[model samples]
Target chain A: MIIAFTSKGTDWDSKMDPRFGRTDYILFYNEDTQELSHLDNREVADQAHGVGPKTAQKLFERGAQVLITGNGPGGNAAEALKQMELKIFVGAGEMTVREAYEAYQRGQLAQGA
Target chain B: MKLAIASGKGGTGKTTLAVNLALYAAATRRVALLDLDVEEPNSGIFLKGKLKREKQLFRAVPEWKKEACILCGKCSELCRFNAVLKLGKHILVMPELCHSCYACSELCPENALPMTQKSLGFLRHYEQDGLDFVESKMEIGVEMATPLIEQTLAYAEAEIAGADLQIRDCPPGTSCSVINATRDADFALLVTEPTPFGLHDLSLAVETMRHLDKPIAVAVNRVGIGNDDVFRYCEAEGIPVWASFPHDRRVAELYSRGETLYDKVDSIRTGMDAIHTQISSLGGGK
Candidate 1:
């Protein structure tokens, strides 16, 4: 499963972004391969509207099975993510990417719809 | 000539000016009053007339067809608004994100996406003596106000084409909606107050009008309430201060009762005449 973390930078040491739709970066951690990938989402973050749905759609396209962030996606975006059966976990906005992954592993983060 | 009555700040009296001017101008020439603030169209609350016509308006949005789609994901890739998504062989369309730009529907390789009508708003026209009042009420929760304003202007152009002058009550502020309403006007009367916040926003609105290359003038409403900064700013910017209506207790009383002010107040009538004179100088008079 590829766990996606909304981040402020390109690496695991980067701070986790609290925002879902308008996050600066999307870090994907693959469980099987132990590989980490990052997608720059600066363009999507600056849009006037539909940022939530767009971000959700981008996650689904990138094969992100789970989402971890500070705050969850908004109404329209949550609906889109739900369509792809993507599980979302919230309350990691202030943590580093590595710390959020640890919390997700320990099942400390709250599950979001 | 079409004169748009707009303001940078709300409650600064764009509707007050529009209704009074249209009512005063109707004494001689045929006047058309269009309330283009479709989001909260309260101009109709003051101008009561016989309902002449009512029309429902629609905007075109793309609808995804399942069997016709080739699962190519082209439509989703082409959409800039993120309205379309390819989710497990089905291209789901979120109508709220659609700007109706037609790029997805027109460029679809399999012709799976087709444009369909979605409810935009409703327009109601009322005839009172020599004046024609048209108000557009946008559909609830519609964020974009530009398209509906354009449609209302088009309708007014066709329906009241014979009117000698048009007075449009615009949506407040310098947003895209305000630009849509005022872009085609021959002149824009920017109503403002005399306060600091009013002056700051008025400056922004004046800059917007200047950027659009539209001729603008100012009207300070609720006179004597705020400071003189708004007047000083207008003078420094070389924007003419056309009319000033005093802060009167009776004015508020009449407004609270949803009554027009032209016939009730002598000062309001004077303010209306001054605005009428300025517009007539621009060849609006028949």
Candidate 2:
């Protein structure tokens, strides 16, 4: 399973970005392969409208099974992510990607409402 | 001729000038006053007491048909607004983000997505003192304004055919909504105040009108309250300053009470007459 974290940087130590639709980078961790990757979303952040829904499309196409972030997707985006059956975890906005991932592992982060 | 009343800054009295000019012109000519600020169309508040006609407005968007599923994902790819999406076997459609362009529905390979009408807003018309008042209000949650403005313009075109003048009151700022309101106009009257902030925003509104290639003029409202910066800016750009409505307590009281200042105030009557004369000349030009 692939886990995605909306982050400010490409690495795990980088701070987690709370905004799902306008995050700078979506850092990913592959469970089976143990590989790390990222998708840049800075351009999507500057879109005039529907940025949330567009960001949701990016997460869905990347085969993300889990989403870890500060605040989860907004209404339009939440609808798309819900349809994709992706698990979303919240309460990691001020933390680093590594810390958020650790919290997810320890079952500390709550599921997004 | 389509004459547009627009302004860059809010509360600069675009509605004031629009209603007053349409009223002055309607005395001797066939006139239709269209309030194109659909987001908050308070211009209708001053109209005479009657709702002659009302119509619900809707825009077309794509609807996904699960039974006709090809799972091609073409609709999602074609949508620029991201209103359509394909998640696994199911396709999701959000109508609020759709612009009603019909691109996704027409280009679908398997004909799975069909165009469906979604409620956007409402339009109303009233016959006020020989002037036809047309106004529209967008739905509360609707994000886009251009689609509804387009629909209202079409309705106004039908209602104002053979009319002597079609005066449109544009939305504030030089955004897409304002463009949709004033793009069809032959002459545009931009309303502004005398402050520096008004001058700054007035320049932006002028740039937008320049891009639209419309002949433009300016009206200074509440002349005594602020400085002469707006007048200087208009003179520097060679844009005519058509009317200057003074800063008067009576005007404020009348406006707050849903009354027009044309018949009661001498200065306002003269200002509206000047605007009416200029717009009338444009009708003869074409």
Candidate 3:
């Protein structure tokens, strides 16, 4: 299945690839399954004060299965994302892009896939 | 004097303080209110002003000419924002990712890249009940608010140059747009509540003001609800406390209806006067 992972908060410019850190949206495609996954880095948008519901909706429409973020599944955002049938993962700290993908594969995410 | 009212966190009464201050100042002095919170500008709603679209602002994005273009990836290499993409003979420009630094055009070897203006948004002006205001509204779906804020600041500088006082209502957080809004202001008035979250974000706001080298004072809103952490921080850091507005349901009711705080709270006038006096004494009004 296609899976998308997003690193949120603190810009993470030096740790992650600069291209990945600056992107507000990321799309991952699985060639074998012909599936697409999308993620929105809400941390940057949150830093800018607030994120609109449209951003969350866009990720849902793009077929995101799970949203890997640093913030927990609570507050208004949790309820909003829950309505879209997207699983929320929190406490994913400082893991490399590949490591995060591996964690997803191992079913070690905070939210079950 | 240009006083930028800001807070690192939202829901801290930044807009309330700014609108009241502007209204109070406008009573005697000609005051202009410029809302630099382009992302979510609510000052107009509070002031109940009818906004007129003054001018639309645009920024230049690189447009590569296919006829004269080589497949050289120099443009992409030079763009720090990664706005330029080289795909064989095609060079695509993502306007959202562009910072308008024009580094790509400066480094283009074939001179195939020409900067073209893309509409970011518009600068709107309005007047209501003797209060003049200006706001920058970014085009819907636009990610960047920095350019629009910069244009708004420029407009404020040019138009409100000779005004007795100018109160700028800024967006939340200490990002580039917020920085641009308050960079040239004479003083920054940081409004915050007394909660833990308020104190946490107040520190961020302090750091930002220090970075900008702007003289700052704190305004504690909803004084009785939260603890004394904000006051303690102010006393420890030697940052002056300009004013304090208590947690009152009357104030909330007026705020919900877009009435200026000075009109709602009689005590606010005294605080505003003191703030004005303090600012003028600091030569901000000159």
Best by TM-score: 1
* lDDT, model 2: 0.87
> What DockQ, between 0 and 1, does each candidate earn?
0.65, 0.65, 0.05
Clashing pairs in 2: none
Candidate 2 vs 3: which has more lDDT: 2
lDDT of 2 by residue, B1-286 (tens): 8888999999999998888777878888888888889999987888773788999998888888889878988888878788887776778898888888888888887788889888888999888767888899999988889988998999987876867688898999999999999998888899999998899999999999999998999999999977998888888999999989899999999999989889889999999888877776666433
Model 1: pairs clashing at backbone N, Cα or C within 3 Å: none
- Error at B278, model 3, angstroms: 1.7
TM-scores of all predicted structures: 0.96, 0.91, 0.72
Off by over 4 Å in 2: A42-47, A70-72, A87-95, A103-113, B283-286
Q: TM-score of candidate 2 restricted to chain B?
A: 0.95
Where's the lowest-lDDT run of ten residues in candidate 1 chain A?
Answer: A45-54
At residue B108, what lDDT does model 1 achieve? Answer: 91
Write model 1 residue lDDT over A28-91, tens digit each, in one string. Answer: 9999999999998999845787788888877888898999999888988987887887788999
Query: Candidate 2 chain B: minimum summed lDDT over ten consecutive residues — where?
Result: B277-286
Tens-digit lDDT string for candidate 3 (B142-190): 8899888888888877876657788899999998888988998889999
In model 3, pairs of residues that clash are none
